[model samples]
Target: MPSSAPVAAYPTSTRPVSIPGRKPRTQGLRNMELAFLVFAYVIVLAALLQVQLGVMGEFDFQLITVFGFLVALTVAMHLVLRFRAPQADPFLLPIATAINGLGISMIYRLDLVNPDITDGSVPNATAQMVFTGLGIGVGIAVLIALRNHRILQRYTYIFGAVSLVLLVLPLVPGLGVSEANARVWISVGPFNFQPGEIAKITLAIFFAGYLVTARESLSVVSRKFLGLRLPRMRDLGPILIVWAFCMGVLVFQRDLGTSLLYFGLFLVMIFVATGRLSWVLIGLALFVAGGTVAALNMEYVRKRIEGWINPFDPDFYEASGGSYQLVQGLFGMSNGGLVGTGLGQGRPDITPLAESDFIISALGEELGLAGLFAILAMYFILVSRALRIGHLGGDDFGRLLATGLGFVIGLQVFIVVGGVTRVIPLTGLTTPFLAAGGSSLVANWIIIALLLRLSDTIPNQATTRLEVTT
Candidate 1:
């Protein structure tokens, strides 16, 4: 009886609980994010300092102001995420900041050596700095206000309308500004804006919301053709409309890059949402056919194609629309060799439009093949993380939206970088973040903002399971 009474008082275990399928989202990793920003700032500042010393024989004191401005802007956005988007991915902002900072430095370097700049005219670097601040401001506003990405779905058609308007704005009589044979820009007083840049973001939102609603019909109501599941004629309506829209952009807007980019984004998103390869095949067919037909008729298109085919040909160099820039860029990169010519030491300014269209070449000339690879690796990493978030996203709209946005970045990089490297035709597309353009910067930063917000909404499986058990 005494032994039984003594055995009745056992203690319970107090070990840490491990939920079977839970991965809690308790840690924000804000410190880690800030550390990356600091590292990126150091690299940017060091590069700029080298450029000043290498070319100007001393440090540009203005860079100190630029550095302070960028750091403050980044910190402001960081605080927004810390409070508003606590679960957002930590690396996106830092990566973007690094690319952007490097771009600004490169532009400044090019500006310092630009013999083309008139005595009283503003340097592109100063303008780029202003744009960077504006872009960061826009991004911060988006992050602080947008608590949920799905709210975009509510204005799906509205986004479509807005995108349409923006696209057409460049085609308007007085507003449209034709530069370098691409009429995808609008002039507002002294400032020229590429409305198509913003259009891409709005169109992605529209495509995501639209496809999610139509996925059922587009996926199941299809026929097998030549061992592939091809959507029925009625089900093919959306893709067909998209193809026509792409062609319209190419023809009217005169932007082969933007047209190809939009179509590619839609085609990939459709396939992802429906698990159908037919859409891709069909889209490629449409693009090739449309592009070939346009090339045969359009003077600009023909020149671009010919240039890509033989950039080094003297005919290409001496033509009305010569590939002198392309040839010059190739020579610059070739001169860079393995490591680099050391930032300010190279003749990056010799290439036409070196700050924007040929910025990759400018970067390649100074950083060399190894550095170019590192920069591309950063872009690939960002795209991979975005895809990861999308694949893990539970909601169809969020998944599609995230995936589409990621593709926009990936495909655009391919188009622009490929053009620079002679892997594809010159398409007048600016490199994201690294190229000098305010509209591109603003649009891209907004995309980063949306992606961060979406990541915040994605729940951790461990947290979900733990909460359920509790």
Candidate 2:
């Protein structure tokens, strides 16, 4: 593509010549941001130590592994941004680091309670920190090499096909692992991963690229109904295909949460591309119909619905399909009250999967309602920053990609939180930074990378002030 092509994929800072007038410049505040990041690390490390001290009643030097992991992760990322992306967003890296560090702390606390595992491997806390480092490594790689977000657009079809394959891999014989009634994991030797987590990123790129090329055709409407434009029947083919795929995931993979996420992401991107309410209405109708049919025919879906609808019923509560986990999370949070019971003081380990799916409840029990609000506020800030980047993107492709990525984080959090609070049926999904899943951490960190790259493209004043007098 040409430097001045329709998308302007080249960096503005690289242009040797500019309009001759002087312009004000705003520095990227990179050093200030790095300082704040270090401060946040201090708090997180202290919190983790507090947990250890409370439980062990003594200072322990064995916490060096966690310290080394954080130092390596932060140093690697900090060096990358300083050399390669000095002008990127300041808050995102810090926010992610804090959330991820706190998650490890919570997991370590649970590890203390458990103390022993089936095969007697390393501690869950150490394993989680290792994954955290791996996640950071992916982000740094993306930042160093893929300086522009638009490059991914060139291979949209390839990414789309790969995403589809990843979604189906867990269904293959010997690879798929069925746990807690969801066959969404693939076991490779000793390692287990959810391909759907990686699929979210690839599929977002697919949706963005597909919509950008097809928006002109999909945007036009021949008929108006009640002052709203309804998408043409011919234009609806793409969404129908995606919707059907999501239904397939629901049926074959038995992962209702991932299916809902895929469908919701596509729906949002289509609406943003076409500015049509009719598409959303149609998309929602399809999901509801598909979900209803699945609920009737699929025993797992039926059980999920029954559990959501009647959690307290005598037979249902005690049955294998019961909402015991949900109810227990609620109780744990309630026990937390206004302020938390303090770290290591409460028993969040009592809940099933407290380190992954129900990490929020674990935090709630230890950190209290007030602490949860603070944590949520941090998430709100992170999402808002990503959306702000999307809003300022110069081209449709960048705009849509940023929007889709931001919504990926927001929607996942809402789904996990809503499920815990009983606002929606429980779907077994990992919490973003707060969960103990490596796939989720890696995927989310890559998202952070993309957002940083996207933000870098929107020229700050400093980027445009390089014009010389000639």
Candidate 3:
């Protein structure tokens, strides 16, 4: 004999329930990231081995041992992301690591030929290794501390103020240091830092945050001008102010590259924010007008323009601040042809600034066009993923921030690579992670961390929606 409670009958039909703003756990994202990291490390180790065999005619076990520590740090970063940001983009870290490793190998090759590089200062390769480690550490810290990407919006004006101070720091007496005709670095004790590198990051945050609230006003349409809807005269203050700021950077700091990068970044973000083609057109006209004026009035600007026009001119080639470096880089790349001169076999050392401004050329000389294309492809993938993250984001601020950061890297690459290849006049901007500068390394790595954070937080519609069975 059994006493039974009435059985609760389940519904036969099932329906999907909508849950807005609900986040679901992502699967296998960390595993994919780990796989890519391992592949990146393998590439780094192979490149280092080839560099050693080519430069030293033998392997150096001591250097490899030291590099193991850097690898360990990267592994630690991967583990941190596994725990903190499991949904982050997988390609960012591995791509950066591979490029950084190649840079280290190239720098090491340069170090082998230049014995005087270590006189009273750290060797370029060693310093770069240290910077890479520090950059990775900074990235890890960013991921650990910054739990949400939206938190940055709170400090938009503060970031703006900080960027302005950074831009102006190079003008301060005793603390300011001028190098390579640009007054954009500050000297503190024995270290010289380029604040503008970090300023770009801050400025991006400011632009994104400012635009989030101001896009509607800035997007107001007036009369049609040249078949495009233009903004009202009253609403033009922001663009004008930004244009003026860029001109100031050009005139005072003599840094045309930084000015262009900052302006282009703002222009891209504003266009994305407002969905206005007229703003881009207006921004372009303003920049062109400004560049034309600077070229007419500034001797250095004129020289750079003239150099870009005719680098092979005998007089310009032999001039003090002319196209010698440009021509040498071209010649070296020509010597490299389709497939590079093979690591240490080429005389890339003959080119000045090979380790810094012209690292792309140095890479072209050794790795050939194929290798350069491959590296560029990696950059493309990295930037495209960032833009994708922006596209997938549910919030306006996160979308704008991701887009701004992506443009920062893309524009900087175009500026550097274009200048090197004579597509544009050269300006003093580092090649992101590949160039030998601690400030740039740290700033770019922090950018990677921000992108990772944003990726993790982007709402996945597929993952969030669930079915209920009755």
Give one digit per residue, the lDDT tens place, for model 2 in 71-181. 778778977887777767888988898889889999999998894665678878878888888899999999989977789999999999999999989988889996637
Angstrom error of the Cα, residue 151, model 1: value is: 1.0
- Candidate with better lDDT, 1 vs 3: 3
The all-Cα superposition gives candidate 3 an RMSD in Å to the true structure of 4.0
**Residues 246-303, model 3: lDDT tens digits:** 9999999999999999999999999999999999999999999999999999997999
lDDT of 1 by residue, 1-470 (tens): 45654443445434446565544443436667889999999988998899899899987687799889999999999999888887788889999999999999899999888876877898888888889999999999998787778899999999999999998998888899855477888899998898899999999999999999989898874568789977788888898899999899999878899999999999999999899888899899999999999999998899999998988899998786779999999999999988889899899888999999999999899899998998999999889988977998869999999999999999999999999889999898889999999999999999888888888777662222222211
User: Sorted on TM-score, highest at the top, how do the candidates line up?
Assistant: 3, 1, 2
The root-mean-square deviation over C-alpha atoms between each candidate and the true structure, in angstroms, is 3.7, 6.7, 4.0
lDDT of each: 0.88, 0.86, 0.89
Please give the lDDT score at residue 151 for candidate 3.
Answer: 92
How accurate locally is residue 382 in candidate 1, as Cα lDDT from 0 to 100?
Answer: 88
List the candidates' TM-scores in order: 0.93, 0.92, 0.94
lDDT, model 1, position 314: 92
Which has the better TM-score: candidate 2, or candidate 3?
Answer: 3
